[model samples]
Target chain A: MLNIVILGAGNVATHLFKAFETSESAKVIQVYNHRLESLSFFKNKTEVCNNINNLKDADLYLICLKDDVIEDYASQLKYKNTMIAHTSGSFPLLQNIEQSGVFYPLQSFSKFAELDYKNIPFCLESNTKSGIQLLKKLAKEVSKQVFEIDSKQRQTLHLAAVFVNNFSNHLYTIAEDICKKEDIPFDILKALILETANKIQTQSPKLAQTGPAVRQDFKTIDRHLSQISDEQIRRIYQLFTNSIIKKYE
Target chain B: MLNIVILGAGNVATHLFKAFETSESAKVIQVYNHRLESLSFFKNKTEVCNNINNLKDADLYLICLKDDVIEDYASQLKYKNTMIAHTSGSFPLLQNIEQSGVFYPLQSFSKFAELDYKNIPFCLESNTKSGIQLLKKLAKEVSKQVFEIDSKQRQTLHLAAVFVNNFSNHLYTIAEDICKKEDIPFDILKALILETANKIQTQSPKLAQTGPAVRQDFKTIDRHLSQISDEQIRRIYQLFTNSIIKKYE
Candidate 1:
């Protein structure tokens, strides 16, 4: 079995631990976090360490800590025999570590959310060929989709992810707000949302775009702006309208 | 049988004709368009008429024309005995038509695409109660999800749809652009996109929001913006970031 030590007790850590528990080739040797409260959940499942000094030897030390603390922890991390990897989209791999690599899973993690690894794309990179080869085995054991991506490419993936996931979700939030103000059930728009997403499956988003912005209907645009009472939403509407018009033009 | 005459040869017109062909009560007796070439597809399926004057008598005259031409067509339409309705999300019902209503299907329609009306939300509005009752039966025949929405609420739904469908699709377009630049397959983000939409089923979009912008991570925000070379997309990123920050605050 491939021994693993997971650092940090956030959403990613919790989900990783759960997935590792099911994998036949891997066992989490320990899970370490600075906070005792976060470490409590891992107590019965595996060895839980609150102090960084008590981290044990494992095949891989997967760091799932906050972005700010990742470099600090990695710089102070004292394991010489284990391969060190971080699960960050935007962070640079520590060159100071002897066998450093990245094992980034591209998906939003919620503490209580049920995660299915089949569809999630895992991006892996390592300084040494052996590190990448080992990481690949572990990745395939956990996920069906894996991509060999460097740090720069991984960073770009994260940025693009922010657009597709974060920004798109915010647009839904804005739609929900509009529905709330009009006392219309936001549920009505869910079908439209699914259809819009389904369109992207076979078509480029460029050709798939349709609205007043695409048709250049200024009258309808003005009418929509008039109904929007919130200043922020109105500005967002105008900005997107301008961009869309520019795109179609 | 409810004989129907459909005007226009666009995406919406084509889809409606197909759906109507499957309905037992409604049979498209005639498909009318000013352009003979646009009416070629309906030649064997139904009677195709190029001239408006040759329009056959039908129970309903469904005008699925362009928004700008909708009022013009309704005003000049000679079918006074029939219930004249236009499938427009934002256009007003033609007041001159004695029997007028709206048969707006709240979903994006594309040419050469399979459309299942089961999940599509049909927003219906009528000038008369009798008209609504008749339209409700027809709508139920076409789609399972039907809403009797007024002009104001219909307009609001259209606006919200702009955010969820149009704007969210644009965000996907932006992500595609980013991935294209990095030589990464846009397909990698599809699962994440689906997950984002699925989250709205059990949770509000506000509660589902995640990212550097949602977390107010200035370091990551700065990193993302610096990498985005395209001036317009960068501006969009900053604007959305500001909106998200204001939202969570």
Candidate 2:
């Protein structure tokens, strides 16, 4: 079994620790966090450590910290020859370490839901060939899809994800707000959410776009804008609708 | 069985006609379109006619025309007491017609793919009691979720849907374009898309929102925006990111 130690006890850390513990080929040797409360979740399966210096020797050290704290954590680690990796989409593979790479599971993790890593795609990158092979093997234990991506490519994918997922969810929130204000049931809008996402799976989103904005029906657009009392929502509507029309034309 | 005559032969017309044909209680008696080519799809199933005057007797007449053509088609139809309805999210229930309502299946339809309307929500609205009953029955035949929404409410929902479905899909298109330009596989972005949608279903999107813009991490935002060469995409990124920050504050 491959010995593993997880640092940082945030959402990503918790998820990775749990996934490793459940995998038959992997064993969690230790878990570390600055706060004792954060490490409580891994009490039974692995040795939990509050001090970074207490980090035990393991075959692999996975740094699942926040993007801002990653460099600091890397600088403080005393372990050497341990295959070190980070679970960040934006952070580059650490070149200073002998065996460094990335183990980013490209999916959102929440403490409540049990993530089926089999469906989640893991983007693996490393500075050395051996590191890549080791990380790839570990990734296959959890995910069906594995990709070897460079830092530049991973960063591009991260930016694109923000537009597709984060911004898209915000749009749903805007729609929910509008429905609430007008006393329309929000469930009426739920059916379209899945359908919209499914459409782009088969065809380019440009071909799938519909509504008055694409049709460039200014009269209808004006009428719809007038119905919203919130100035921010109206502004968003006008700006996004204008953007879509301009892009298509 | 309820006799239904479907007017227009666009995506909505074809989808609705096919869905209605599968219903045990409903049978399409006629299909009408001003263009002969549009009626070719219904040639085998119903009495396809290019002339509006050729409309036969039916319990309901559904005007599945485009939003702009809805008014024109309503004016041309001579039928009265035949319960006329239009399948549009933005268009209000026809006030000019003697028996009018809306049978808007609140999901995007494409001719190339088969959509299961069983889970798709249908928003039903009508001026008369008999019209409402007819629409409710028809909606029940295909969809499990049905809402009695008025024209004013539907107008708000449609606008909201534009933000959530149409505009959001446009954002996805923009992201895909950026990925293509950078030589990054769009598949890497799919996990983000699915997770983002899943996040909104559990929590308010405002709480789930994350990115360089929301966090005020100008360093990363600047880096991402600088890499994007398209003026239109950069403008959209700026507008949406600004809107998100403004909403949170």
Q: What TM-score results for chain B in every one of the models? A: 0.96, 0.92
Best by DockQ: 1
Leading candidate by lDDT: 1
Clashing pairs in 2: none
**At residue A61, what lDDT does model 1 achieve?**
90
Against the true two-chain complex, what DockQ does each candidate achieve? Answer: 0.78, 0.71
What tens-digit string does per-residue lDDT give for candidate 2 at B1-249?
Answer: 999989888898898888887799999999998889877889987799988777888898899887877888877764555788899988887877888889988877778777987888888998899889999999899889889988888888788888878888888888888789878777777666766766666566767777777778877788778877878677767877887778777
Off by over 4 Å in 1: none
Candidate 1 structure quality by residue, lDDT tens digits, B172-236: 99899999998988988887888888888788889999999888999999999999999989988
Report the number of backbone clashes for model 1.
0
Q: Model 2: residues >4 Å from true position, as ranges?
A: none
TM-score of each: 0.95, 0.95
Task: Indicate the docking level reached by candidate 1.
Answer: medium
